[model samples]
Target: MTVTERVRPGVDAGRLMEHITALAAIGATPDGGVTRLAFSPEDVEGRAYVARLMAEAGLAVRVDPAGNLIGTRPGIDPGAATLVLGSHIDTVVNGGAYDGAYGVLAAIEVARTLAERGVRLACGLAVVAFCDEEGGHGTMGMLGAHGFAGALPPGIAKVLDERGVPVGDLLAAVGGDAERLPEAAWAPGDIAAYLELHVEQGDVLERRGVPIGVVESIAGRVNVSVTVEGVAGHAGTTSMDHRSDALVAAARVVLAVRAIAAEEGVVLRATTGTCSVGPGMWNVIPGRVRLGVEFRDVSADRLDAALARLAGAAGEIAAADGVTVTVEPGARTTPVACDPRLRDLVAGAARERGLDCHHLPSGAGHDAQIVARVAPIGMIFVPSEGGISHAPGEHTAPHHLVWGADVLLSAVLRFDEAPVARG
Candidate 1:
């Protein structure tokens, strides 16, 4: 199972850490997480810094219409499609350094290493820094990948954050012209394959005492908003049976959702993120209640069954309480499985390096999921310290970072030698 390829000196861990540490300082939050919103001033400056580094590594860089940064290293064959290495540059509110940043940084390191040795492969390498993967304000994550995949445009026309700034307005503020946003998308034939390196984002690897993880599939997500309405009544004198408690209905809805998720199996997960009861909560029986429910799993059929059960339970509970329920389907995205060929390549590379590796499913969503729709996609993962992420305390040892990068390099080399697969 070992992929015996010529191994060059591994990337310098010191240099890799320096890049992440320095970029983290730009939008450092009070708690140590980063807050660089997409198409914001901080993002503009951060991207500029990355572009400069890419240039230093001998990459020909370009900024597309959607404000995505792409750096290309041309191979001997100019007619061949390009191998893409990319991830989002945006971060969640107070997110950690190793989240999206690690993928982009690792690509940069790989390009640098290749250039230092003057190694030229069959296909060109394109390092990409996708925009707005975090969806901090617009609720539109993976905007850049979606655009490139032809599913949607990267510049959304009329999305406003809490402060009233339109999504298009935000793009303009960061030197992105909305009129030219259509040029951001890529044709289906342009990409050879896509590879992403990211943090595990969970405690699985650390808990299992493994150094690296090769993701098998990315989980699909279903988000729903449920509102329960009932008659408002005075808490002082209204009898318990006479009063229609909206809060009680909402509570039951939450528990029912949890039950469906548990019954669905280990791959299925559910969460009731928000809940509210109207008026002063001290005494009055609430007249209205609102909540959001989200479900995720690797199997589409299983997810559908879970949602059906959840809907049934919610309706029954609301009917018993004399309350009406309204359900709004928020978002439905299919789970993406990584390219099996590329997955095997990564596993072989890890074994060649004498590293302990296993295949694991990613519970969190990623930019690679969008890319999977258009090209063969693969992801390499490193352990998250204490399985912590999206926080300042999130970390992975320097050695582990280098180890993952080494595996990535070997995998890329093996992929370069393989035949182009066309279906």
Candidate 2:
């Protein structure tokens, strides 16, 4: 019941900003963003840097086969489980700073605060930085946490990347022993709960004039790859009526996707992020095309129906154009509702800090979604300027960052005393 604001052991806003600034320089893009791919040399170095930071804070560090970094501070009671806090560090090509970095920094502040206060929980505490949440290497997104949770399949060790290099090989080189379970370093029962602090990748908080958004659920995401194939013909000689243009067929499907969302009367969204047309030259008629379609919604069933409609539309369009169409389901992850107890804890922290807070659903995917499956999970969101993310223009002012850290500090303290376990 005690709510007091004091400088937690290592909760230095200036120091946290310094860490973010230094990490940004590692994969520093020419356009003021970062481009470090997961499990690459750059990621290896970045992981090492974070490990060093954790070590200096007097935490023991270890890396699992899935490349997750876990830093633990032992508490007085060894029988109780540990509290885990983290987000992935790998970024999309040219991604912003606060997305994944803020969570790790906030966890570090938690460790610093606990150390300074000389407050030991009944259980241990761990700070983790998961690897490759972006799926940049074509491996499983949230692979690190998935492995830790025993959700990773046994055979995924041999999955190859774009360069035909096996994941097992890569993991071995990075000091992770690929055994029966990729995350042999830790088991599912070790973590009592997990929490992530991140920037709201949308304008939700700013639009509502709130400082913090307690996530209710992480939206489900599904990707469909649609391929349209039509017979090639001479561009100039073939009559418009006789020609079977794959590009034309693909365009119709794209329009249908947009139309489906508009007609559904639901909060559903679909996007074609990538497109490929064959025959490269302007004068050549396209014979084949590939489009990447991704759909997201708060409801999993609604997302399924929308994807089904999209597939049906693609089939109809291809039939009309005399083309062969194929739809392949790619990445699929369901929405995760935050642990209610932790959600209330976050709201209480915001209220104690005299900040406006609202309960919101996260539209973007995060490592916390994966962690929630194994541990009780909560998220604290800071407002994003103009709701921009995944770009160089993504911005969160320093004050927001500091405030978020303070809220995170309070939540950790609450969890430390009255532990909640999932069924």
Candidate 3:
């Protein structure tokens, strides 16, 4: 069937916007942004509000051991694998309103629309609000989704936030038992598919004038902490030939990092977002420098190759500048491709709605990547105003938000009608 023929009026844009506005108000900052860090009081309150919304949508609500909020609407076949739709609600510090919250709200709108229409399908529907996706309070990010996928690390309980509070305690506060977090993991047959609607978080969609982006893959990430050491000396008295300036060497490494990514093409990205210099003084030469280097790409092979080249170049630069450099690896996540079947489904839905669809790769990490381990996963992206996100200025127009939600609704219905595969 043609996409246009399948189109139907679904989500109420006005009601959806109201939900978004009310949720944004929970952690509203003085600067007009949000601060709903995961497991914070504001986060808990926001979850409570979402729970009320779930109840209003006629779904059974529950919090999993991993602190994931799940709202389920049963289908005709009780034993069928379930269709899950959701995203995280937690935001980064002073983050924008739509980053993660939009996806969760969109899922709820889909369920509400289905319930209101009395539409029943073969597979059950589950709307989830994943916790701690924004790396709240120094905790490992994507905590809830990772736990659900059984990919959470072994030492999660021992992990502490900025407040010295263990993640276990935080989980307990939110009705989750860190000791029982293992029980939250879902087996292969538990979920039929997963869907998420999010803002593009980049300028690609906006620059291209496309209303929707059907994600092709979520890029892998590698983070490294680099420290360069050199002898401190008086800036004015030290001759250029006698100086081993750490900052100078660090700057060379940063430039090299950027050049390498540029050589590798658009799929590869490298960044040095943080830099620290010791003995901050105008007259003193820098003795030590620390840089936080990050690399991202859709191909694991390409990411590894880039990291190797970067490390080699850093060593060369350090040797040339007479400085000692140390590189320490941090968090690393593999790249993940969306299910081809599901990707096409999203594209078809957008076409049916008469919206311009663009295929793109996500540069940012997402909960859908973690869930992809167990189920076929797909993502829908709406344009962020001026390609801004993770800040107060981040926004997707009201109509764009509604359009993405409508696409999500269409995709969910299509999944429900498909035949289920069971082990």
Candidate 4:
């Protein structure tokens, strides 16, 4: 096959776009975005639309007990492992159109092209639509991914959605049997490999003028909550030097989070995303404050070093401010490196298409990381306009989206066309 033909390989660009536009309309936002939060009515509608697309692509579709949608194209050899392609369809509040949706729709287009051409693989092709990838407004993020990995939390049945309704109930509303969630778990060999396509959600590719990124690793993330407590006093009556203020201490802790990272030349990014202060009234001096500090890095050692430095900083800040500071660590997940062979296939496809390919680590967490527990994983990234995501401005050009699919299809074909080995 000619290089151009191999790269494009009959992917219907217009049809691919049709799917994107249609899905974007389901949870349409007035400011040009979407909000199909997990388990929301809008999310149900969005998944239904994808199910229709999957069916039209000639795949047998079903929803797993954990609410993961799987559409499978039968293989030439029934005993062979399945090659899975996927991305979540749910979006964050006011999220842009292409974040998780592009990867999914693009995979369907690839499947449609393969089916129309009558090409069936030894390894069956399955497309997954993982639910709650954004964590359903913080009620346990990556729920579907954890479910598929058979790593779901024990308390899942008791977890509630944003509206205080049981998540299990919401899953049922979308055809999921929460009681049978274990049935969704795929054994180690069941999924031979997992591939995902997504927008970069950062500016690296765009700033470097690269259209495609071969993910080297998904960064490990750790979050810690720091609380500072002091005596509350009247804003007008208390002397600034004699009175204790938790907000002031918390602000210092927030700045120290960044200062430590920068001064130590720490590889991880440290952010204080939230600061809760009470009493909140303007006339009341704040007596308690909590700050959420999160750190992300490709190296676990680096993350540990960061935490150690944070502890020392907190001690100094607490003593200086005359307040008690406590640091409580939250979730900590190690980084997942992309499979070496698959990484090369994606890179080769990008080069074959004459697209500039860059290798980078993913800062944002994705389903691919969790799925890595059961199968080898790979990821492709198209440039996010200005590295924007989870907001109204998230964008990738029409052609960029198609090119990512082309690379995804080419990589899948390369893997399928090669000789197979079994343990």
Report the lDDT tens digits of candidate 4 across residue range 251-366: 88988899766766675588899989988989989999989999998889888888888899999988999999999888898889888877887898787777889999999999
The model with the greatest lDDT is 3
Global CA lDDT computed for model 3: 0.89
Candidate 2 versus truth, CA RMSD in Å, comes to 2.3
Tens-digit lDDT track of model 2 for 176-248:
6667454343555777888899999999899988999899888998888999999777888999999889999
> Least lDDT summed over 10 consecutive residues: which range in candidate 2?
1-10
| Rank order (by lDDT, best first) | 3, 4, 1, 2
Compose the digit string of candidate 1's lDDT tens values, residues 1-423. 233535556676789889988888878899878888787677888888889888987899887655578899877788888899979778877888888888898888888887886778779899999878888676478877776676664347566777777767766665555677667767767888899999898878888888779999999988988999988888999998797888988998988888777764633688899887797477788999999899899888877877777778878987899998887778998998898888888888788788888789998999899988788889999999888887778888888888898888887788888834634
Reference-based lDDT, residue 8, model 1: 57
Evaluate model 2: give its lDDT: 0.81
Give the runs in model 3 whose Cα sits over 4 Å from its true position. Answer: 1-7, 263-267, 419-423
Clashing pairs in 2: 9-113, 10-112
For every candidate in turn, the CA RMSD to the true structure comes to 2.2, 2.3, 1.8, 1.8
TM-score of candidate 4 against the unseen true structure: 0.96
List the candidate 2 regions with Cα displacement exceeding 4 Å. Answer: 5-10, 180-188
Error of 1 at 207 (Å): 1.9
